[model samples]
Target: MEIKHNPQLTSTELATLWNTYMADSMGRCILTHFKQTVEDQYIAEIIDTALQIAKNHIDTITELFHEEKIPIPQGFGVNDLNNNAPRLFGDLFYLRYIEHMGRTGLTTYALAKAISSRKDIRELYKLWYNQTEKMFDMAIDLALENGTLVKPPYIDYPKEVQFVENDKFLGHFFGKKRSLLAIEITHLGTNIEVCNVGQTILLGFSQVANSNELRQFFYRGAKIGKKQISTFLGILKDNNTSYPSTWDSLITDSLESPFSDKLMLFQANLLSAIAMADYGTAIGGSVRKDIGVIYARLMAELANYAEDGAKYMIKERWLEKPPQTHDRYKLINRKD
Candidate 1:
């Protein structure tokens, strides 16, 4: 008889699974609220789909943790939510939020699948990626049908293939520079949209956060988001390119807290982290020296904001520690 041993999950697999579980749990709570408050039937359908996906993720991760004998993370749950709280966002915001989640979900799942060594882990992420892709497509189609999708600025089609002539094509630091490339325009427009989402969500959080400190933190974050939006919009306008408008109106004036302060703070931190990642990506893709400088500066600001959030969470004991390798120094120093 041949004997085969099942391989254990790697550190990368464990970390990814833990993070996914936490995020999905929080997502479930938020989606549950959206499902209850959303008015449009079509938008409600999307919320229901997303809520189901989040629930399934929580269940699957729990099973995996049980099999591995790993203590399941105490992620967000019903206690963190106030379902009877009045609606804090418009239906359009809910739909747009789902679309943004789908995009980020694709990025996260793709990275997890690529880094996973265990066959089962890779297969799990692959399934999630495919499912999110479908959801992303659904969102785009629905947004178009509803006439709410704002596309990137259009440019005249190139008549013929052309090549960069000299270093002048790479934009300047002080003097007049070359026109923005299509890719540069796309990045600016994308960052604008992302900032709009962040600002709107933070604005809502600020209104309902329980503590004054939490409210201040969210208010500052929303301000940063608004500043970033203005910067991007100014760039697009200077280049004579059209850009998408902010979604500030999507937020309602509801002061009742729908989510716990911990959840709200975590979400604010998450959005800042995502914005930083996106700014870094924009820097990598941009050739314009000025544009790269702008992205770097914005990313630094976000880093500081995120650091403060981390400190606050740590102080409040709201941040859960992830798995870490054993401390070799402590082990060696101990008398046994």
Candidate 2:
């Protein structure tokens, strides 16, 4: 396909295109995984709905690209998948992955809507965002039904500190002497590192993606990471903690090529999940309820994003299949 430069493609337009492409590509990948592992008819229905949304978006964007006479970005296709591979995870873990992905999709769609300028693109985003929101709700319900969602320990009030004085357990030893402010500072630093890592990954992937939409998605994600880093720094300073030095290492600099879409999505989702867990732990350890709440929300958002990415990986056959358990066998001959 001959590529044409459409100067009318504003930054926002480019971003929307990128998000649409990524979402569609990943969604198709996850749907394949769901078809192989999901047992319950109801749960399968929900997964199907999500798949439909992704497919629809892909079609819509393709049409848009055609209308604009712009070349659509090349991404992973059905040929890249191997859905019949041996299961890699249990059914419970698979459900958990889907639940997380739905949440992530919602966040990404919402962010895209906020930044997009063209009415046609914004309208398309609104439609997909609503679809993602529905998918998230359905995933949560399915997770609850299947008992797969992780329930964080509920704490009603602050508890007394108990120091574990063991040199081998570095976390325990360091945690004992650290004030709440100090711990918050450490968490802030970690968050900054995660954001930087994510940005680098996205930037590297963006440079290699053939689709304009894919590149834009990475750029948008990079922008979001920058904002998040700024926010964390502000919180650190407000709490009278020193901000950590900026991350200067470029993981992508040594690489000459772009990552495959499946690989990129997998890495992004995995990183987001790790960050979510870290943020959640920070919230639990923080003394300030307000700060805790903020971190908690951010963690939730990241969790959702990671889950979405995981679903796509599964569909693409990049991830392993979840395991299945059989019912207990009856003792047919023991009665004699």
Candidate 3:
């Protein structure tokens, strides 16, 4: 129950404790989507993989708990599921959800590995991290295969741009000129548009979800996306850049559709995950620490939301089985 950064604990104990907690958390989240429908076989397979990973971790942790005389933590159950949840989004969104969850999972497990002192725990984290990486890669492959993943416009390298430095109350502001701002602003606008589209899918799904809990989850996510959009807009404003008016107009034409609730949730999760990665990269490229900090926070928040959503979908049995790798040699030999 009480986990400390205690030096006294054994490696197995630590790994068991951490994994048990995570497994239970993930299980609870996934169980929410049990009995929900999936439109795509590939997406469904990926969801299954996500579920398998959660279930595997839970099983492992449960065994460890029993061996250690520690009571097994209660995992996710039918009680946590919303079988009657209404359809809130289309099928395209479900694929996006798997993609996002994979990215978030990779980042999270990597972080856990870095902080883990125990060798066994580190190895376990490594396994999960690798699994997440594979999941992300597969999602990308699937997206490319399906022609759904959006690629940002490529810009040729430009040399020598005039950047201005302005001193203000809080801090000194320094950035590229108005013309460059225009370019950056344009890209930011594109990201915002993608984000809005994803959020719309989620909102539509939440509106129809039969379970109040699932509905609330999607509603909360919509609010988060709105707040993030506003934050991004404020960043543009501070830089004397015009925010895109397109986000407001890119509304979903229909909230009710043939899409299952699980699929809708999946799509929403994927979009948010992609946004997190894109925004994080954007922040890293910015020269200003303040701006970077803002973007970083946004990325973290989005990752959290994606993870939460993925957990619920898995619990509800809406996820698909992930592709497995046979040998390292096979992977190395595969054509790019």
**Best prediction by lDDT:** 1
Candidate 1 Cα outliers beyond 4 Å, as residue runs: 1-5
lDDT of 1 by residue, 238-300 (tens): 888777766655777789999999999889888888889889889988999999999999999
Which pairs clash in model 1?
none
lDDT of each: 0.89, 0.62, 0.61
Q: Which rank order by TM-score, best down to worst?
A: 1, 3, 2
lDDT of 2 by residue, 102-192 (tens): 6556766777878876666677778888888888788778767765544322223447886657543322322233333556666677677
Deviation of model 1 at 329, angstroms? 1.8
Model 3 Cα lDDT, one tens digit per residue, 1-336: 444543444554465455445444444354235216565677777767766677776676667557656555443345435455443444555556556556556766776778776665677778877877776787688878877775443444658884456533223336442332334555466566556665665576576666677879888888887777777666676666556553332224443443346645655665676677678667655555566677777788888888888888789976543323358997889999
Candidate of highest TM-score: 1
Query: Which window of ten consecutive residues has the lowest lDDT sum in model 3?
Result: 246-255
> Better model by lDDT, 2 or 3?
2
Q: Compute each candidate's TM-score over C-alphas.
A: 0.96, 0.50, 0.57
| TM-score of candidate 1 against the unseen true structure | 0.96
